[model samples]
Target: MKKNPQQTIPFNWPHMTGKELFYIAEAHFNGRLAGDGPFTKRCHAWLEERTGCSKALLTHSCTAALEMAALLLDIQPGDEVIMPSYTFVSTANAFVLRGGVPVFVDIREDTLNLDERLIEAAITPRTRAIAPVHYAGVACEMDAIMAIAHRHELKVVEDAAQGVMSTYKGRALGSIGHFGAYSFHETKNVISGEGGALLVNDPASAARAEVIREKGTDRSRFFRGEVDKYTWQEVGSSFLPGELIAAFLWAQFEEADRVTRQRLVSWERYHALLEPFERNGVLRRPIVPEGCVHNGHMYYILLSKDFDRQHLLDEFKRNDISSVFHYVPLHSSPAGLRYGRTHGGALDVTDTQSAALVRLPLWVGLTHAQQDRVVEVVGSLTR
Candidate 1:
């Protein structure tokens, strides 16, 4: 009789701690079904404490948080926002929707983040901000990037969608920049089906941010009883996430450290098993810069220059294992090509890296036996 194939493993999935149902029930019982409610408050407090930000406002998605940042920075027509070419479309979409031009920059080969060294060259009189995405939960060179932003008088908005509770030199990834955006989408380490948060570092912008999140109304203050009534004050959009999502997110927060540790163990296991392949030039494992405490959100490998990453992806599927590729170099994407400027630099690293990288299965509930099967299949494909 033929042996049975192992169950199909997912790349990433929502890992519930058995606490979500309780929180959902609590939200239902409280009779507050809208944005500003007790569950939302709890989620906000959890994020503020974890990120050490002055305030945290939950939003419908990371895109909304980024759009809020764009609005707060006063991005307007003809203004330019510099960002990495190897990022999600939303990174540039937020600014582009505000009538600003997204100036694409190349990323460092090691971290796959915006090259801080190349930023100054991209700066111009029309430059308004620098949006650096912390790819794969590895923090970017924040100190260098921050210094450049300070001298150029440009706001820094961290697109930390993959970086939650991650740190660079002891400072939280999102807290280091003027503004930061985090995601709780199902694909991320934390999940609320779809939710995100905007971290406001500058104290002066807190009240305005609150208004912006509330669809340009002073409703947040009104609800706090600071004002008797609410009214629209400035140009803004509906960014606040509903209470049901926040309630689900709060359950994940309750098991924050435990979830992180579980993923870390799996990440380490992959690194150890794959180290020899990296040493022998068969593949390259992730490289976290010094002084960074990553959140174990992703584990990707770079295949040998001659090996086709896409071929391996097909083979993984053939073997009933699931692995995936990432960002398609935003500069080459149709929208980016049409609306964004490339700053006319060599994107050799960005172009090649995007094609060669592949992310393996990673999630809280992934078992060691399942991970071994994945590694075995990948190893066979490479050999």
Candidate 2:
């Protein structure tokens, strides 16, 4: 008889403690199932403290937070926003939906983040903002990017969906930019099934962001007793998340440090195990820039070449592991080609990096034995 294949390990899955149920039960008992309940307030407080952000507003998703950011910025027709070509569609879509042009730029090979050196070259007269995504929880060259933004007087919105409580040069990733977006989707480090938050670092932008998140209404102010009644005030949409989700999210936030530490340990183990391959030129491990403290949101390997990456992914699947490749450079994507500009610069680095990279199975509960097996399989493939 043939031997059975190893049990399928997921690429990622939410790791929940029983604490989430208690919070949900409390939400049910409180009878404020809508947005802006006690749990929502608690979640906001927790995030604000962790990120050192002036104000944080919970949204239905990171996508919603990003959309609200674009709206708050007043992005208008033909305006251009510079971002990386190697990110999720939502990063560019948020701006594009508001009739803004997405100016795609290449990423740096080391961190796979929007190349700060290339950003200056991409800015045109129409460029209004720089949206830097902290890919895989690694910090971008934020200081350089911010300096460029300051010189050009451009707004900086950080797409920090994968960065939560992660620090760069001792400052939180989300708090460094004018506006920042975070995700609590099931796939992220923390989960509320589907929830996210917007970080408003500038005090000037916080009031307007609160208004925009509450569907153009002064509801947040009204709830705070700033006004007797709430009414619509600006162009906005329903971006606030419900109380139950916030309650579930709060449970995770309460254990944020522990959870992050656990994930970091696993991340370090992988890095240690993979260093030999990296040194041998068979693979490249993630590079966390100096002065950056990441939350270990993801772990990926860049193979020596594209063909090796594909072969490795195929073998991982055959071995009952779920390894996967990431984003196709947006410049070459069908929708991006239609609505975005490529800055007319060479995207060789972006294309090559995307083709050669593969994300291994990583989640909060992934066991050491499972990780060892994954490493073994990858090592065999490369050898």
Candidate 3:
């Protein structure tokens, strides 16, 4: 009997910076495995220094971070928040959990981010905030979005889950909005298995943001000797991640630049090799506008009308290569239709992109041969 071939390629493989376990041991030996310990503080400092946010609070997950943002904004019943529909359920669910409505707008054709131009039209008297998801680590037109928010006197929460180590016009993605969230999930360029951070950019919300992460208490101030004793302050949750997760993340943070560079090498290789496919109109490639530096968080292509998106995904799976389709436009989902309402007009761009986008295997340390194999399988399927 012959053994079956293993799945040679994966959609994502978490990268280790060679110091994760050592730091984990250090964290354990340091006698604190809980949240807001030494390792956790280090992670917070790292984020604040890097992104220049007023405060960076580590969360158990990006979802939790978004929930914190929703709380910080005080989103109330009947309030509406404008955002793109082509995003993860968390983007809408966070606001919905607060009894706030999500106004789903269409995305841009090229970058697939929320159309900044359409954001204004979605605003109404009930609008409380604008949540712009930085899809694929490529930013939304934040300058325009910020201006609109200012004009409407609304808050801005950036869903920058894929925007870690990414920037827009010389500023960090998460640091631009009043609040921002980042995912350090195993699938992201950075990894702590399942971790995230909420960046409090607006100074006015800084103190309350801390209270919210500490389960509606002022424990952070107590720990820092800012107050004699802490008590219930506001609506909040237990959003802090454990010290071990931060320990693992600290090791990766030490090598973020190198890790990002390696991913870019793979991303560029895929873009170059797939050029012939793009030229032949076999597919459409990702669009990176000028001045917006993405973190190579993903490498995806849009299948042309001639190609079947599902067929390509199936072919990759059969060939021991892993590929995947991205989000299913939230507006079309059952929960979306019930809890959220579509704004601006038709969701043509969101609908088409959702059906066509297929993300290729992109991970740090992916060998050239493995990448070529992925390309070969895609080409074979397209042909």
Candidate 4:
């Protein structure tokens, strides 16, 4: 079969385990489509077993999971949560919604993750927590971050939305923090259309985490026969996803290892292909520091200072190759201006990196030939 000359490669293609529809049908046959049903239990168990967190609860999205973290922390108006400016809006928005002030921190140059060294300086008397985002699946320096949090008696929420299956040292990215959140969104390596899970690492907070996920009720305990009746226990919202979403996510969890391996293969190929560009000072490839194992969640290139990122992206469009830029630093956004404050006076690294980075087409079934074409376009346009 001849391919269409104008066919465009998408920036992301959701992976399917072939059992998604089957499981969805099974959920229907079981006649339980509510939240925390059998499939939800299965997914929760799988996450707890794999990540070794004290508890796991599936949420509708990573944003929802983060919101649950905020509620669990009991964030009040005027309370501050420190985080990186170079991250998705949800990382800050979740806390901001709880009447909390998001204190924007700078990210490390190499990993583009929240710089642990600067976290201490951002803390104040009203500081409630530190939210570290694992950028592009590469982990933040959790050991240092945790030590600082411990010293300050503050909470740590790991935004591992892109860090699922990735690890820091020997520990899973999300498992190391007090609360870790995962995303199974269609854009993520593992897909359930739109899904996420919160990993509760602290035993003390597990029960409350469940209650918060269940709209501030003890409904989970009631169903588990732990309570005579479930009632509103605290301030919370409906964060849990329905049974059908869990059923779909269960299939992804079953094949999570395989999907991660395939994505790593693609990610490595991009690394090798982009090496020459990096060496020639045309572009820079991602840097994964030692002890950090990434899940190949994304492959993004940073154009050298002299090169125009938009120009190269336009070239990709002309060649029918889909390429895009990532987040605009949250500190610069309108909401951030209104609801947050920047720490350290200047976020030089975040501003520079966020501007130069561009993500290329990457997915489970992307071909070597297609990758070659991507590199070719990159080289032609940049050189």
Candidate 5:
């Protein structure tokens, strides 16, 4: 067998703006390899300026940020946090680590986000927060969700891990909630290898967020001359990434807009090329509601009930194209079963959508030729 002439396309490629090495070198020369150095401050400023967050504390990973949110909210044993079962493990694990019960909710068939309508019915006296994950960077119905939280006085944590440059009705995704988290993993629109940020929207939580990221100390305050000295003040952990990661991130931040634009170009091309398949009843394309601006974080398609999704994926493999499935509903996973319970009797929609959806290769710098190969392979397989 001979290798195909068509170039190999990966699911994701971390984009760079040509300044990463320069900044990393600068950080090393500045002699601050630890967290909260000059580069870290610049990254913090970028996040605050971009998202309008009152304060943004960079963390080692999105999981750490979510865990910090759980801690900041004072989630205690037996307390309940309502969230969709379709989300990642970290979404539930963060709360579960604090001994909080994850009351799982079903996701909307359209956006695959937590259904806002079902939230009120699922709330109980023990419910403390509502963690709404912005699936695929398209926001949940935040207006309705926010109203429900206001009525019940529950905290809202926006898991905007995939939504750095996305918005809903002119408001940034993470800025709408009390606490929001973003990821800069290699797979995300932004890349810091493995990094995340915790956005504190409430002004009151800004100081505490800083302390939490610095291992339960007021070191940040002391650095700012707000305190005479630093000491461990609360139960916390080392969540901040070293300055090297921040230095690399600063480069990405500089070109964040351009990176998002490039990804959007690829996303639109996929949507356009595949519309005929959608019209022919071969597949269904992603939907972006009006006023909701997504970051083109991913491009996925859904197959009809009669279609064998695995068969299509196998076809792509045979054609020398790479495609992959999305998440396995967390509620059905072992940890989810042990630490959580579902709001509805059966999460039928979640299970069905999970089975049908397949994510196509998408990333910045995906050439037209490569995209054409993907579109051609998909068209032939579906037709």
Candidate 6:
């Protein structure tokens, strides 16, 4: 089979560590294909140790982890959770499912992250938590957000779905909040096909997080031989991934550092390649603030307002490139209008930044030649 030079470069390609199948076979040999098996425990230990969280629990998806966080927060009807509008719906849906309202805040212009400055303004008597999503694996202003949370007696759920292997001021991005949710979706820097984890930073909520993940039971205690039998105790659902998934993830965990390093190399290359276009005002490259270490999970360019973004996208398509836009501001979406409200009257930054943003093809194994072609297409089309 000959390679096609004209074939489109994909936006993402899941990386493998060459040990996935071997681990899966080992799991089968161990006779524990169920959740919380040996492989799952190993993954748990890795997450807890790497992130320095009190407890780490694997879940079927980041959405599940967030739902677990929502449950742990004990969000009641009419309660409010403040977060940015320029994020995945899961950031809001997780709370909406618990009958809580999502108060949408605008994003920061530079980092495209939740505006920690605006969070305090959105706080009200009904505010239960502040969910700051770490966009593009770049950390939000956790110190300020945490201080606000403390002042208002609010919880912080760091939506660090893209923050694995990334840090803020030397601390892991997800570890700074009261709770953190990470995604291991196929498109993420790390993959388990479709998986995630919950980081319980507060010890008081650690035990209940386990219960909520296990369908609201002290079944975790039972498994530890602390109880003779497991039984329903509170509000929870099945959030665990099977041993097969854990086995696959363990292979990725083994190579996590390598994966991050490779991705960073490619990210830096893109940064260098796009410098001229940025100077010419063709587009704005991503901004990584000082003290915030990112995992190179993404590389995006924000086009100027006058430029025709869709025209450039069509050109990329014709040129066999796979550049694409990011999220549509959730505050204006159908579900958002129905289940949430925009704070301070408008999400000006969120709407503008999301519309202009175009994510390039970034993945673990993206070649220099492929990246050149991708950028070449951008320059040809935009210039």
Candidate 5 wrong stretches, greater than 4 Å: 1-6
Question: For every model shown, what is its TM-score relative to the native structure?
Answer: 0.97, 0.97, 0.97, 0.97, 0.97, 0.98
* lDDT over C-alpha atoms for residue 363 of model 6: 89
lDDT of 2 at 27: 90
lDDT of 6 by residue, 1-383 (tens): 74443366888878899999999999999898989999999999999999999999999999999999999999999999999999999999999998999999999999999998999989999999999999999999999999999999999999999999999999998899999999999999989999999999999999999899998999999989999999999989999999999999999999999999999999999999999999988999999999999999999999998788998899888977877998888999999999999999978998889889999999887888999998888887555
Give the runs in model 3 whose Cα sits over 4 Å from its true position: 1-7
Screening candidate 6 with a backbone cut-off below 3 angstroms (N, C-alpha, C), the clashing residue pairs are none
Q: Whole-model Cα lDDT per candidate? A: 0.90, 0.90, 0.92, 0.91, 0.91, 0.93
TM accuracy, model 2: 0.97
Q: What is the lDDT of residue 161 in candidate 1?
A: 97
Off by over 4 Å in 1: 1-6
| Cα displacement (Å) at residue 64, model 6 | 0.1
Q: After superposition, how far is residue 291 of candidate 4 from its true place, in Å?
A: 0.3
Error of 1 at 76 (Å): 0.3
- In terms of TM-score, which candidate is stronger, 2 or 3? 3
